[model samples]
Target: MEGVVSVNPNHVCKLHTTRSWDFLNLTLKDVGSPQESDVIIGLLDTGIWPEHPSFNDTGLGPPPSKWKGACTGQNFTCNNKIIGARYYNSDNSSDISDIQSPRDSIGHGTHTASTSGGVEVAGASYFGLAEGIARGGVPKSRIAVYKVCWAFGCSYADILKAFDDAIADGVDIISVSLGSPWPSDYFDDPIAIGSFHAMKNGILTSNSAGNSGPNPVTVSNFAPWSLTVAASSIDRKFVARMELGDGQILAGTVINAFDLNGTSYPLIWGGDGANYTIGSSPDIARYCLNGAMSTDKVAGKIVFCEAGLDGSGVLAANGVGTIMSDALIVNPDYSFSWPLPATLISPEDGKTVLDYIRSTESPTATIFFSNAWKDVMAPKVVSFSSRGPSAISPDILKPDITAPGVDILAGWSPLAPSTVYQDDTRSTLYNIISGTSMSCPHASGAAAFVKAAHPNWSPAAIKSALMTTAHVLDPSKHEDLEFSYGSGQINPLAARDPGLVFDASETDYINFLCKQGYNTSTLRLVTGDNSTCNNIKPGRGWDLNYPSFSLYVKDGEKISAIFTRTVTNVGAANSSYTVTFDMPPLISVTVEPPVLVFSYVGESNTFTVNVTGPVISQWPITSGSIKWMDGTHVVRTPLVVYNYLPGAPYNLDSEQAYTMTRESLGLTHSNVYHKTGMGQSRAHPQFL
Candidate 1:
């Protein structure tokens, strides 16, 4: 207890993709992976299905010499491709569906493990949908599985233990696909603490951004030492169609693999078959709320449940088919196959179908099989990928980059059900799933690729390569800019040879934590060395050697701040770099000594970007980027200025209040003060 800084609940974190390599152009034939045979990617999830073809060792050599891990799971074997396998359940937790060893029963671990470094598997498909050669970013990279999650979700203690084992086990990159309900302090978060240790040992940890998105401030992995990945899309999508009697076709969402062969079924509204004690009531039966429909009335009829997931209800009533409606799902590009002849239509479509049914005495419709199509809006961040302006570190950007997460086809366990619907009894080797969980492994594999090419690079350097060399996303699609997509979607090949990398060492992170308010002695509890916060500069966040820059200003405050950043050149020798800015609206940004000349590789250059602008009144946020171009390679990172609240004061009365300390922010800063209520400042909390 003496060394304990804080106590956190052993909160059970939830488990949160596919193609997608070809979408990024990291194809099996095109990708020139350099010596990736030795790179080991450690996965922390449920567990792996060792017998899956994706884990086949075929041409792979033995484990890397640096791999000090072991296969400790009972009855679980690790091949040359998967160098190690182990499982952790500190609470000895068990579910009826859980397996007792590292063997995956839930399939999440297998899905993620193979997604990160699975061997190339030909004829890989999800029930003949989105069919293609399933492959990871670096197919040749070795995998080490650490199963920390179970049926009840991942325990923080187990997660911490897995992190400890992963670090000690000599993993080159750690891929964690689970996270807490919310991000805690770095010292308190198991992933953060473990990743910090991993970073110290030259291992980069890539974590999911959490699947609570389309909503802001939901990111759960925000530690600067690790990479927090957001979820995006690839170039593909899926849909199902329903045809009315008049031949009017309505495209809906559902992976209906079942083919009715153009057979029309009589349509009956749920209300017509209401099992109400008071007799037929369309209003009550409309939702088809479990057992609401009468079996005799709905039997052999295509039931139209106005707005509900009454697939089971319809089935119990002996309905041949069902049409459901959801008002919320608008233009969603993903769907899953249901066991029955089913399709989910939009609320507007539901109304039109209801009208068609009313107008015709005998309404009939046919549901067709699911089909695949190209989505022009591919690579847009999915609605479920968590958003951020991190609560842990406001100045630093979270979800460092976006990767393909929606509808990812990867290795799955035969022990688990393929789709979310339990009634569907179909099983498969690979399953299509979506979440930030899928995106994390893509980034991890990419990081492995970069690390394999540049073995001498630090964890931070590899991260910088991925971030700076990423493809800049369309600002029109990502209105939140860096907060939503970070440095944009990852580009692994470009990352292998990033011209410049914003590298940060242990001391740099210590300073970042110091700026986040950790005092010297408390910080010692973490670093366990003679680390001090004395060198911490007076800033909310920009002082750290982060890839991007973010500043917070209050309403009508004259914007002024200075950000100093350092970059280590990893490009060609005798390279000259000059900075260019996509300046934010109505804000002036100037970089001093803009030209950075690197005499040789690994040479470091530091630059200070100063800003002095007129009183700005943008209530929410505006973002831009600066590119350091050397004519051959361009290194880019986002620059943002925002004011979350127009005239709001520092909220100190909340249920979970964020109270800043003077020793951390007040005593060290130029414009420091203790605010009892709402106050205004040039550089305040950046929340929107």
Candidate 2:
């Protein structure tokens, strides 16, 4: 990736890119055949490296096959050489659809695009997205590069324009590797609205879940329409950095997991500055090593600030002595350092080092503090990513999955414009980068591959394939929380072959809308609002709804929404699978198309369910219980109850069916219903 930028020395770029959990599960053979699947993928980033050797390969070809400008009012041909790139900076004279968008101003875009769809690098191939040498998840997929993000940061309008261009160009997948700190208001932010539109049109939109680590809230891609991806560090046995100590800043030994001051080192409590804060002034805040620097009150030695305080840049700038922090920096250990000294310690070794520095009284009275990345062994989530209870609808799930984020090696511009330079090395070549930005392209490429294999699969089906096929359990994490890893890791192989899926249709969305108290008039109003903003609540039918699988099925008297999912191998197109669902005591779920059957491969099915009760589950539904199941495998949806019954019955003439949903399940409430049959004796049912 290459791009121009507005220089801001204090601004910290988002670290950590998103990649798949099954990055190692794919091989070159899976996508090696040239043009086998002519799916077009849109990359919305700084840009791509049109001249990279990887672009010369059969699968990862040059522009015409790589780029497309098929949208109305747009003339960008899918010509390999057309280069329909655009510069968003006001300083640049370029406008939308300039056909020169292929040029990467910043190396980040190029790297991400390369990782997702790059040609194989001899032995290095196995190191990227999948173990397959010379193959991305979707090697044969064409690209529609949307150069939306310029160094000043992508504007909502720029992002919106990119989406419209990409969608009009008919790209199968849209990958956005950039993020903004601003909150996503429903009325503004055309990018979010545009993403929702893309998904409505069956385009798979993938975005970075932001690099905000360890926080359960950060929502990078808040729009429900896009696949918001979080990042995880690639499990390289060793990650190395240079310790800058004037003459002492030598290349350090590389270790996968290291020990700090014994005590099994970090035990995971390291990385970023989750625990400590580094003062901006030139102060000796803390020290990591005992003898590294002696504190002379007169001759101020160095301070070893904790990792999460300021940032790597700030910590290094103080020029205090050598301080040690977790290795959260995304770039490779280039020969760059702050005026102060610094070194990176592994998370596994953080505790003991902090303990030693604190316990031992060295003549160098440097400050030593033990800052952790939330918990022991837990990786720090990057800061730029958005937090959840998403601004749009906190109840709905936004970031559907998480993937490898740290130190990802992708494509880069061989000759970058100077504005993006932290130094010449950063400016002129392919380097490893991290963040949700990196992870999204990986998914977008994978989506292209999925589209080729199952051309007819809806975005929901594709999403299901990606999520259900993902490896939720990574050996790398300490406790292996699902909140962190999400549907495990994305497994393209399993996704490619996911037998059957729960199909969500337009009606399913209508039901969901109704459950949300949106009637036809209100729905129309919302849709009209979206016309101007392009961001609105999903309305009835297929074209208006955002992502998330929704299936409509028949219930007793009315239609209910039943979300059905398929597992691997258990329910194929030709097989009959017995389906059964038991509702929680208080809530009732009616399954539509309850008896799911598939006639041929790639055919999808659905079930309808009516939820009647409080929005909260009467009893917490364990992971797989409320979800659709095919034999032993289970697919899960972060449960969101859209409907709840009114608490008390009104008088016979009273139209008192309206009620507010209880905030929590633990709250006490009364339930009252009017007696049926007016002629019969009056009777009351006690409400819980």
Candidate 3:
């Protein structure tokens, strides 16, 4: 009863995977060290592919004495690089895939494990793409895999079991790339509960900010104690170019391998090739749905398909090439490579291509793979990377940071297929994938990098180092909004020496849980200890001493809130930092004790921020930041303020004043208010 309460089954979320090293400046020769070999990163996912070259050990030593976990199953064994292995599956359901062993039948675990601490694999490439020495953020660090997730999805009971074992096994960090679609209470959510225990055990947990994105309040893994990671791109990008009959050229993004070699083919729209008599209507054919386009009409022709169409299916229908458009907007910067020679253009460009095809009798176009381009405007948050205004606890920022998650090349499981389709049997040692799942391990490796550097630092201190030293800029050199990119893109090299860190201990988090209204019985279930909220005051969730500040305001209401945070001086002794505020319009911010002087390392100073602002309906979310400038170092904390109005349907507790205070900044249903005000609301000034 004290440990893993009950198991709930959930559906599986898809994959995303990694020059990542050069992108993050985490080359093995520069950052790798034996110190990291002692640092263990516990991976909770499908399982590990031990035979993969990435986990070959090579120069690694024996397992650390601190490790308490054991290798499970008959054939499953651990190497020097992969120190421990465990599996958990309480449900005897027949739907489970690969349940008899700890070995990964799915590719996700192998990919994530490699990204976190896989050994350096030279000449690593995915089908001749991203060719170079591929390595994790900290190549020398040891990895321990906990197979909690099978093919169906991760079970809540199994996840909790993995966490209990991982914590007891003395893992330095936990990297989980799974999450639910909606936010759940910390008491009920397995991730939230498991991560809480990991935090208590002095281990940092890095999690994925789910792939459901460009949508507000879709972020998962929002617990303040865990480090939620978002996905972004690096300088190198994959692209494809299209040349139309009118000499018009359009460019899009994708990992296209096939080269047309300047050859042109007859281009036909799917709708024009539809056989209406077979119920393949023009509209349905435009989408390129199954059985919508006739093989006779599509054979050897470059077919233009709509968004959501199965490119592989089109290729199966004898289509030589495919040009697809985005469903939402025309984003020239975003694209994906399909099984066939294909390119994805924006919706606007799709219209132009359609117009040209209708006008010309013999429409012809050439599609070719373009060489990798170094984006001057790099590090923009990918559209698919989940956005936040943390739905669970708006006071705390969900994604602690962003990393290079787009089109990363890493080790792949030979047992798994490269394509999404089951019949595609193509396998490779290295593969390219993308998502926050990829980003999570990037952050985890960075955390391990910091842990190796400062072995004495707590998880909170490690998290603070990363957050305070992050860079807050988009690819275009514009200041990125806080909610979109969290603190900003992670700077692994810079994080190791962050001058000051906002640190919190296990007791601090227990206090936070108490404030969240968990009673003694619930607290015991979460922490597996005799705990009570009796002596703890029901405080504000924002006062949890987080690295960032999140203040909520309801529409048409005036509110004033105070946030208290403490920073530990990790730089040189006798350092004096003067506080400076970047306040957004419609909000006024003032800090108490603007100057902090520390005469010794590890010295700490607490500061209070009093923020007053009116809820402007026009701007649903606005942001600002505070910097502690010590001349040589800048310790920054991003400040986010959103408009959250509490009312019907949600049935949020109004009895609890702090909940009301916290609920005032609700992010979940903020769109309802945005829709109601529409044209009447005046535009507010942008803050970044």
Alpha-carbon TM-score of each model against the true structure: 0.91, 0.62, 0.89
lDDT string, candidate 1, 235-342, tens digits? 877777999988889988666666789999999888888987746477778877667889888888888886535266787888888887755554555554555788
Candidate 3 per-residue lDDT, tens place, 24-96, comes to 7766567767788889999998788888899988888898898888888768778898888988776654343
Backbone clash total for model 3 is 6
Residue-pair clashes per prediction, in order, are 6, 97, 6
Q: Which tens-of-lDDT digit does each residue in 1-688 have in candidate 2?
A: 2231112112212322312323446666566554434576777776666666555544334544434463222322333421344434333534332234446545666677776766554433211221223334565556556666554445555566677778776677777776643333332345455666676677877777664433333354555445777665444322233322221222221211112221111111122112233331222333222222222221233333344222223322323333444435322221112222233454444444445445545423222221111122223332333334343343345566665555455555655421111332324344444456666776777777778877767776787777766655533332313334445456677777655554555344435444444545443332323222123454332222332332222122222333433332324557655545543354465556556565766554444444444334222211222344556444444333222122211111111221221212211112110110110101100000
Better of 1 and 3 by lDDT: 1
Best by lDDT: 1
TM-score head-to-head 2 vs 3, winner: 3
CA lDDT of each prediction against the hidden true structure = 0.78, 0.44, 0.76
In model 2, the Cα lDDT at residue 333 comes to 20
How well does model 2 score by local distance difference test? 0.44
Q: Which of 1 and 2 is the better model by TM-score?
A: 1
